[model samples]
Target: MDIQRYLQHIHFAGTPKANLHTLEQLHRCHMLAVPFENLSIIYHQGIHLTPAALFSKIVEHNRGGFCYELNRIFALLLQQIGFQVSFISGEIRARDGTFGPPFDHMALVVTLDQPYLVDVGFGDAFLTPLKIITSEQQPQASGTFHLEHDGDYYSLERRNGDRCSHAKTLYRFTLQPRQPEEFNGMCHYHCTSPQSHFTQKLVCSRPTENGRITLSESKLIITQDRQRKESTLHSHEERLAVLRHYFNIELNVQAA
Candidate 1:
């Protein structure tokens, strides 16, 4: 990995040390610059989990990707910077109060003074790394996030605010270290299976300074200071324009 090029890709400057402060800055910078997108699936481009493929897509080509692609490459970057990082499997919690199968998602656990749950792939979620503490509300610009400990499993939960009626469980994960290849099956599933949401829609989103901008299918949704305004793309040219102007993605393929 060309560490300097990767840092330049994310616009990260200053000398980096494998400590909490550097980790936090790197995490935030990555989130702001790189989007959580699934255009590869939409365009019928294969999603490869290898480091070279991920780096080429995200850093070289100025593109973003889903969890498997984002998190795996991020883990490699962290390891190169001397951070002790490990891949972990997360079972996504669906709206129906059920959890998906193991390895439904990939997240990173970085150990500094303590372990921090670092995830850049989870769109519009926590911006900074969350310390691996139980039941402590970690308030972020995006939302109020917390973790619940259940024996060996830990559930990451989020709420709109303190006054929100209910907390939504984002995903449940264990601390058990995993290899990147362990997530291959689910990665392929997400890219190929019709049941996977990635295959069903076109989603390219990233967090801005105030809120988030999401290109979901033909709709362009921009949320700023908690106020959302949505507009529809009337044509493929309009959709392509939105992609370039807002998301900085210039694709040659026909819009979905």
Candidate 2:
């Protein structure tokens, strides 16, 4: 799986032998190093959901990717590291209050004695894993996150600025293990379809201790304290510069 290459590229210093603590550490480390981005799709490049393709895109090319690509490969790595990882399809709820179909996004539900909603995909949701128990309050670097029971399902919420609001569920997880190649069709649709957000804008994001930094087209957006800072990007070079300097992404000059 070229696991060592990934760990070294991401600068994940932890040992390969897996355990709960190691998983926790990898969760945070991956978020910091590999960004959650969708720039390839925006630049008219094809997106593949295979382990090789994803590893090349992320670890080798030093690029970032969306949920399907990032989480799919992350899930694979977790499996290779001897963790129980399952791939589940998430329905993205946009800022405009619209919901998409299942497989609109992808995330991992990891089981290690206790389960954790492990996602390296969502740009800036929870930096750490969230306990899957319905009654547990999972503390995060950003804030306290809770997952409440809703009959057979679960609802995720986050405490931000003294207000607790609904956070989108990545997926309803099962113990089923999935391979990254299984999601190829869905990934292709997201990268190519006009209805897909990836095709609409060039976006790349990486989590920070405070919030997250997102680059959309020629704009750079940083959020902290629930407040957003945005600035226009005059040219593609400026956009590429922001991505390379800030996110550690090095893409082909013409790609941006």
lDDT of 1 by residue, 1-256 (tens): 8999999989899988899989999999999999999998999989987778888899989999988988889999999999999999999998898999999999999998889999999887999999999857899998888899999999998888783648889999999999998999999999999999999999999999999999999999999999999999888888788889997888898766
Residue 194's lDDT in candidate 2: 91
Error of 2 at 210 (Å): 3.7
Candidate with maximal TM-score: 1
Tens-digit per-residue lDDT, 51-129, candidate 2? 7787877888888787877787888888888887777665566666565665666778888788778888877678778
Worst 10 residues of 2 by lDDT: 168-177
lDDT of 2: 0.74
Q: What's the lDDT for candidate 1?
A: 0.92
Q: Kindly give the stretch of ten consecutive residues in candidate 1 with the minimal lDDT sum.
A: 159-168
Question: Which regions in candidate 2 have their CA more than 4 angstroms from the true location?
Answer: 95-98, 163-182, 223-228, 253-256
User: Model 1 off-target regions past 4 Å?
Assistant: none
